[model samples]
Target: MIVKYTKPGRNLIMVPMLILLTGVSSCASRPPSSVLQPVRLVQNESEKITLLAITNRDRESDGKGFGSRWAAKLTYEKYRFSIPSERKSTAIVYPSKNPDPRRQFVVTARKQLLDSELIDDATSAANFDGTVAVFVHGYNYSYQEALFRTAQMAADASTLSPPILFSWPSAASVTGYVTDRDAALYSRGELERLLGALAKDSRVKRIVLFGHSMGGFLSMEAAAQLKLQGRRDVMAKLQIVLAAPDIDVDVFRSQLRDLGHMQTPITLLVSKTDRALTISSVIGGERPRIGRLDIDDPMIR
Candidate 1:
């Protein structure tokens, strides 16, 4: 796919909010997203979408949900979510303390898997063309949110590749812009290791990396890091997709310069009228973010 760059208009500052404030619900009001919500295991097997999760977030001591704290080591696991069969044209339904398997998305199972074991599953579960999709979530996302989101996308998409998620330690709050940014940066080495491991897998032939929002920034940083280390093998098998990336335009340009020529062209999805980006722009010293793109700009050309 083609990577298109766009410039933001001068009116982005009018929205007048911060990229850090989102909803009315506090962290307390929200149900535990990572706790394994009950589901009829045998009967709901058909509705299950399992994810290969690689995270650097510290696991909560209760073993229910993954907290936002960063960890010194990365962990690999597989989580299975049962998609609600009774939903209409709605988004993912997060399971609460008491959830209906037929109406809300529920966490059916969780398993801690070895890194090599995950690679084996990923290699064996590739798409027809040997493509493995890795999803890197954006800012203010908890582990369960990222996990279920990947499952939702997998269930909606046409591809048969098994879903994989690269979850960094996001503070999981609307006010976590700076916190999430630092956490994403700290997890770059972990992401590099995940990509490198997939590249080294003999059975895996192609990899499609998907990043949204701030995760896109982390993705670019890891790619640059890999290039500096001269990991041509990993770069050869990788294809990048950045959707609504929350990256600074100048930073992205510099990252591009560092990456040089890629084996495959990067695909970027951008919008000119994203109000959320306007808030982010104002916060970033009124500098436009990449997501607020205007492709007609001469510099983009």
Candidate 2:
């Protein structure tokens, strides 16, 4: 696969890293096994899609639903399935002739696996390709939302080798902004542990960290934590891509200062016109969020 790069000043932004899909995508909702056909047509299309997830969200309804609070028990789940492109027209994966909420696109998933075995499975998959992509979701996201979002990103891109999700409990409500912020901060240690696990896994060659909104802050903070531990080797093999980060500019600068010189290249994707960020700016004492970056500002320069 050919990778593309765009450099704006010192920052190196990778194109087509995370393709955000908008719609009714759910991790719990999966396509059936009938979608996987016996024939192989296009080599470009994915044969199988798998996402390894690490989460702090509490399980609900006897593990049927995922809650929005941080749990002391760190759980891991592996989701795998074939895409719509891989099979003939099934009511699953591909939308029906007429839109039917009752017949929504479903991608079937394998039985859930727990514990370090999740890491082992991901590492084995990476052994052949030596590449892995780690995705962190923004605030106001439930555990399943984060899972499906990352799944869509990985499947749609078709370029990402393997996708892994690091899900922190986000309260999943607009009213829980303060609570979510605290939770994001608290998740730094687990993020560090996840990153360190991937970095130390000899089978994995490179890691790409992709973060959106509050997840971006967690990504940077986790990187800072790793740096403080003198894990330059891990940083060397990592690439960071942040989109519309809801980070305070001052805090971001301080995190950068703590990081000092970094081996990993961080790409920041921002839009000043984002109305949600505008509200965040107001709530944050009129200080512009890092997502609404001023490129000309010497702080970032």
Best by TM-score: 1
* Residue-wise C-alpha lDDT for candidate 2, range 35-69, written one tens digit per residue: 32122332333445777888887776455656776
Q: Can you give the lDDT of residue 170 in candidate 1?
A: 90
On lDDT, the leading prediction is 1
Model 2 residue 100 lDDT? 29
The reply for model 1, stretches above 4 Å from the true place, is 5-29, 41-46, 126-128, 273-276, 296-299
lDDT of each: 0.73, 0.66
Question: How many clashes show up in model 2?
Answer: 6
TM-score of each: 0.86, 0.77
Model 1, 1-301: lDDT tens per residue?
A: 2364422222121111112122111355455654554454444544766678989988799876678998888788877777778855425567656677777777777788998889877766534456788888888788877777677767656456567899999998877778988998999999999999889887778788887778889999999999889999999988887766788989988889888888778876666555545656777898878766666667765
Residue pairs in candidate 2 whose N, alpha carbon or C atoms collide under 3 angstroms: 30-106, 30-107, 30-108, 31-106, 31-107, 31-108
lDDT of 1 at 72: 82
